[model samples]
Target: MITIVPVETKKQRAAFIDFPHDLYANDPNYVPELFLGQEDLLNPNKHPFYKHSSAQPFLAYKDGELVGRVAAIYNTNHNAFNKVNEGQFGFFDCINDQEVADKLLQTAEEWVKAKGANNIVGPINLTTNDTCGLLVEGFERPPMAMMPYNFPYYLDLISHAGFAKKVDLRAYLVNKAGANQRSVLLLDKLEARLERSGIKLRQINLKDFKSEAEKIKKVYNKAWDKNLGFVPMTDEEFYYVAKDLKMIVDPKYCIVAEKDNEVIGFALGIPNINEILINIKRGRLLPTGIFKLLFGKKNIRSIRVLMLGVLDNYRKLGIEACLYGRIIKNAMPSGILEAECSWMLDHNYLMNHAIEQINADLYKRYRLYEKAI
Candidate 1:
């Protein structure tokens, strides 16, 4: 017999976070998420998202053995911003058994419906601004920081459970050794043209992180306003994210374009820490994971350009290309060879073009799903 139980007690919550570790025990590509980080994310008082929305996590079991998990979320801010009665399902993981997937997803759908949601969309992990989607393509390697990964069988399980693709997100991989030299040569010229317009790009100042984040937040809110399912992040939420990133943020990889002291564009790349996390053993840092995370950080060889955006008025001024070029050049000294720029909406032509200019290949695709409640 199978049963679905709401994650209520601390022990149950810990199981919710640890289930993937056991589920993917034999999968080499699977990287366990930090227990501490996952705890904060699931904690209503810890994550700022709780200020405006709520989530309920559930675990599936067959004769007392864990089989699946899911989070039913009612993002009030998402509905308010998009003007739609949509709830989201996230943190989803399940076995190959269709019954397990069905029960877990059904639990989530019913929870969202009880909250007055008319439609359900997921696997948002929480929200579109955060990590969402299932890896429908590119299963060759482990995922980057803040990215999602799962077995390919997950695709069939989700679809068979009645979810349909809402949109496809793309990720591009650029190798420093194989970058198109032609585009690299054009970067200097691109900089000169932008310089003539009084636009200059520079690395983010770690010394003045608070002020810098404030400026970038403004540009970020405006730059990605029209993106599919994008909702302006609350100041609290942005700060929450910024504070966490400040730890791994490299000055060289975190950059901004300024004109008259206003940030018009920005790019952020984080060390591919999944390499170290993979060895952290179920994302626990207590017994030894902490040392692995701290000491193994320098050994990281790849970076993920998780965010790059320019204000609408700043488009076509070569700012985007300059940002990409700067990140590539800066990465050379760090022994970084390949980087992934990801989660671009399939319809975002200009941003996609900018990535291609750097010789980044469209290597991975992730999809979000939706269904009427």
Candidate 2:
């Protein structure tokens, strides 16, 4: 018999977090999330998302053995901002057993229905602002920073459970040789051209990170307003995220553009710690896991260009390419050989064009799913 239980206590939550560690124990590409980070994310008091959203993690058991897990979420901010009554299911992990997957989906669907939601969407761990989506392509290698990874059977399980594609998201790869010298050669000229329009690119100011992040938050919320399922992050939510990212955010890889001292665009690349986390043993930090995260961070050879957005008014001003050029230029000597620019909307032509100009390949694809509740 299979049982689906709401993770209500600390022990249940720990089991929920550790289920994947055992499920993917033999998969070389599996990367472990930091146990401390996972704990904080699930803790309402620790994660700001709980202030405006609600979530419950569920674990599936078969004959008393753990088989799968998922989280059912209702984000008030997402609904109010998008003007849609969509419930989301995220942090999903399951075995090939269709029965277990079915129970998990039903549990999530029932929870959303009780909340008055008419439709269900996701595999979104929390929100689109966080790591969401199922890896429908590129599974041989590990994922870049903040990207989700899962088995190919997951697509079948999700779709088989009646969830259909809402949208497809793309991730592009750029590396040492992929940076293309041709673009580097014209960066100075591109900067000069952008300068004529009062736009200039520079690295983020570490000394003013707090204030600078506030400005970037404004730009981020506005720039991505039209994106599918996007919700404006509250100040507390952004601060909660910023605090965690500040640990791995290198100044060189985190750059911003400006015009007349106002933020216009920015690019953020985080060190690819998935390489280190793959070895973190169930993503635990105690018993020497913390040492690996601290020591292995510097040796990471790749990065994930997680964010690069230009305000609506700043489009076509070549500011996007300038930001890319600066990041690519800085990666040359830093031993960071490769990077990924991800989760771009399928129809985002202008950004796709800029990514192509830098020779980034669409190496991975993730999908968001939806179903009528």
TM-score of each: 0.98, 0.98
Which residue pairs show collisions in model 1? Answer: none
Whole-model lDDT values for every prediction: 0.92, 0.91
Candidate 1 lDDT over 119-139, as tens digits, reads: 999899988878998999999
TM-score of 2: 0.98
The alpha-carbon RMSD values of the candidates against the true structure, listed in the order shown, are 0.9, 0.9
User: Looking at model 2, which ten-residue stretch has the lowest summed lDDT?
Assistant: 175-184
In lDDT terms, how accurate is model 2?
A: 0.91
